[model samples]
Target chain A: MQRVSQRPTYKTIVSVAAAVAIVAVILALGAQKNFGPQQYGQLVVAGLGAGAIYALIALGFVMVYTVTGIINFAQGAFVMLGAMIAATIYGDASSGDAVGLVIAAIIAILATTLVGVAVERLTIFPARNADTLTLIIITVGVYIAIQGVGLVVWGTSAKAFPAFTTLDITDGTLRFWGIVLKTQTLWIWGTTALVLALLTLFLGRTLTGKALRACSVNKEAARLMGISPTRMSVFAFGLAAGMGALAGIVLAPATRPIYDMGLKLGLKGFVAAAMGGLVSSPAAVVGGLLLGLTENVAAGVTKSGLKDVFAFIVLIAVLLRKRGIFAAGTDLERP
Target chain B: MAADSYRSDTGTTTAPAGNGKESAPRRATMAGVVVLVALVLAIGLLEAFQPGGVDVSSLTGGVITFDTTVRIGILTIVVVGLNLLMGYAGQVSLGQAAFFGLGAYSSAIFTTRAELVGIGSGLEGRWWWPWLVMVLGMALTGALAYAVGRPILRLRGHYLAMATLGLGVMVTIMFRENLGLQLDTKDITGGSDGIPGIPRLRVGTFEIWPIERYYYLVWFLAIVGILLALNVVRSRSGRALRALHSSELAAETVGVDTARFKVRALVVSAMYASIAGSLFAHFRVAVSPTPFDFLASLELVVMAAVGGMASVWGAPFGVAAILAIRELVRTRLDLVIGGAGGEQEAVAFGVLLVLVMIFMPEGVVVRVKEVARRWSR
Candidate 1:
């Protein structure tokens, strides 16, 4: 029986290897046929920008999942809320008021943070002892409700959000050797870096952050030490939401803000977080960047429409690999 | 002997000693028969009322339209399968809608574009073609589920959820992009506009139509689906599934092939969704990617959750409750809120799902049953 079981594992490894080889060959051939060096460079840059936003959203996922052991599906909705609220507050895109944009961004982050806290308190906290499946479904419910609220508030039409600054560059874009970089891309990357740095300091240096880390490591132990798991869970959700909102506002100019954009963005963020085994924040950031890069490059090489398919493919592949590539023997929490 | 031991074990551990073990199946059968009769009576009465120019919508205040009833019946089939997988087997497939889409697209593509796929023109409009397509779709979907579930079901909780969700999104993308086939030349799946002019199901010379007949057909299949599910719940395999749901290690220790059972549950559920999808395609006279998207998958989950996940009978109730709520919101919300644009139903569903799972995770049906039992005592 043991030998029989071992054979399928061997078969799985062979099949996975073949699949990877085939994908690599296809990507290479497609790149060779379609993209010049500069085009490749352009795709990479665009991928990095997108990856930065995914990273921030993924950071929120990592925070919530580690502390609460719940994969908050509504994390993406925070991004949507942030973008929609900021766009609403910033008023008409033609105005291009930088100060208004800044204020809108701040207010959006704050409001989204509160929304996140409320979601945790009202939905998650009450059902803290529910099974993982129930809790997961509850988060899904929260996501659906939040998204519905978004639709009622913003309507179905996509809203335009002006770039933070053009950097005085022509057409709000920089070109070098046929590679175009939008000024908004720089903002996304910069904001992502700042958030990451701040998160590192906060998690590493502060007492509250240390307490949050303690709870994630062992909730019972932390509780024994007088740290309230409830308080940390709320804080984690609020902080995650704020980060998600920031990512959303930063990337809003590039990808038009819409009512339902959260689903895709949130799923991609999940893919990123999953790549990190849903526990490691730094690993999640790296995973986000890698996911962004691969998705763009693959989409650029193949059909652009298959871009969404690539993220999911990556997700399934990572999941199948399980303890092989991303994290070593995490053994995800069983229901 | 194994069955006896399992029965005694469950009796001792889960239920009251003797009568609870025996009466449960009997009660389930009685409930199933009652539901089946009620559905048949409702269909006949509705059909009878049709000739008298009786507005069926007036009877139910427009909440239970014939069209909505058909949809509810179709969704009930899907939710029955979902209940088996999630409630009994304790496995989650967030992408059940993908299987539903697969079934739908299979019927749509083969039926609408029979000649394009190299089928003989003679078979294109034949009465048996759609039936053959639906069965084949179920087979294909089951095979796909088996292949996918083997690796995916190994991941426990969040990983499983994410993987299934990804599978669903990927399938939706495929449907939207016409499965990567060129839209300009061989527009087979019809891309985003979806395939229209799908033929109605026919029984030799008689065609099922006028929405009322289709409701009968849908409910007929839904009842069969529910009965099959109920039987599964009472069978040895069902006991094994429930055991697995409670504890995989314990189930394995008791000699249940846990992995195979999980895969089987997934395959069965996928096949159920496929048949329902085929019915939906034929009924709607069109197959679109929109109805089978991620949100649709979530809606199916919501139905299962709302009706009571653990009970096969909860499937129809859940579907009806959700559809009724949606219809209520759609018709009345605009009047109440002023300029409500049909998006509030999602909000209502979302809130309902959260509230139900939080308060009564076993589902409303089970909760009501418990409450009733307590009151009777």
Candidate 2:
């Protein structure tokens, strides 16, 4: 009885500690002499834009993980591929307008979807019955292989493309009250909101999306209901790749896409997904936004290089505070 | 995945039943030991035959060069610990390399920044200081791993992996950013250039230098690492780890301290990485944050997987196999592919990882041996 009673007390202490830490960080950042309220507001807005990208990627992570029960480490690579492919295609074309940007993005998304399906069919499908640890390792392998291919194709330099609908130069900045924002900020917000709405409708109203949801609920029962788990896994990967590509292409204009950029971005996205219980799509978006804001604010106060550190601290803290939130099923009994 | 092989090996060999059954594990372990001795001898012979160093071009067609061999020795030591954690204990750690980097950086700092750490400047030039520093580095890293693993081991599967990944990235960032500590506007972690001039190991005025002597020293430690790992897999704690791996809840139901065992595996593996890191610093006489980043951690996982997770004997060969592929690509494949500018190594390693996971999830060693046995019969 005492042991049972102690568990809740421990939990209460942990939650309280996490809350205090979050508040302390915000207070520390606000208290900095070099930072003014205007600067803080601008940082928050920038953090929101960056957080939206993370949310997009985290959504992809949630989709694949829900359906396939595998965290695609290659999700980040898809993001990189999306952005780089668009940049490369846009650079190669003589045309220079919004039409070229749209065409490039569609091509990049379609191509990345193919790569995602190939990854599943070639590496993941064969080891579907393996343990979760084995599946994670396989994803890591696929990630490495894809990154290598990217390195071979794009070399080691950072690549850039013009912002969507901007044609050639980055010359659109919006000033609101004392805060400055970019037009790309609007693009990120618009894309995320639009995607989330479409995703909600698809999952709630579409037959295929419902089938995919059934697969996530119970693979065996879903199979008995005449839905193929394999096909759903394939579809999930394709959808995730599409989402990742959307995030990558959208984010590329702000931060130049490099061959190895996917690793850090993917990790940050994973952090967000974990914080949101890994299964809830909307929660992941909220977690991503919160993580971005906290990281940017911490950087504003302390040092820029430690921003990733701050984000990871939140990850570790959230992970310890919660248990069994993300595990869909135990894969140990299977071969 | 490797739990089956380990159980069969140790269980079948040590049972005292009166049934007339040959001890397969004993025989296999004996074979493993013999092979390891043969490997060391082969290295000796190769070095003897080519006093002026082995031809790099000749070995480019999938052969282990001498330099590659020593590097593999160091890596094998680290991967053995990983095999215990991932293979036996059934845990995922994406940050083993960070522990390794911490070990290396610790040794580098202790040897180079003795005064900075407030150990006084008098012990700077002493040869024996490095040996003590290596021990300290291992201890400190083990403690850090223990502290970090307690909160993280409670997580299952992918959550555990993410937690560890975050821990690793944090370590790398700290190293790259010099621990955010500055002295007179200078970076404490050497600011990416890294700390150099780490003194080599010496025992009572006998110095180990010339790179080849360091080879024997590293291989000696590698053999010890392998033997120690085998012992752990066959012992009582080893049984507990295997049980925990099979099912943590089941283990707990049976009164096994699952969390304690998991943390033990993590800390032990971390200690292994720490020692290997110390050796790495002393061997190269420098410490850098580059090799301790996420990719290096991933590479370590790749090595362990290639070796077949539960097989202690398979890890060294896994190290050799992966290193040989890198050397082969560096020396031969890049020229043929019109120069991918060093990107081909990742390509080869990545392809190897995918193919190995798809075809031989149990690893190259166990699968190849099974086929060979079938063929011989």
Best by lDDT: 1
Scored against the true structure, residue B176 in model 2 reaches a CA lDDT of 88
| Model 1 CA lDDT for position A202 | 92
The runs of at least 3 residues in candidate 2 whose Cα sits more than 4 Å from the true structure, single-residue gaps closed, are A1-21, A92-96, A323-335, B1-31, B48-63, B182-186
Please tell me how candidate 2 rates in CAPRI terms: medium
lDDT, candidate 2, A93-146, per-residue tens:
553578888989999999999988998898889988777777788888888888
Candidate 2 local lDDT, residue A232 = 97
CA lDDT scores, all candidates in order:
0.85, 0.83
Scored against the native two-chain complex, candidate 2 gets a DockQ of 0.50
> Candidate 1's residue-wise lDDT over B30-147, tens digit each?
7667966786676668656765675567667776676787788899999999989998888887999999999999999889887777787788778989999999999999999999
TM-score of 1: 0.93
Each candidate's iRMS in angstroms?
5.3, 4.1
lDDT tens digits, residues A34-152, model 1? 76678878889999989988988999998998898888999999999999999898876445466777889999999999999999999999988788778889999999999999988
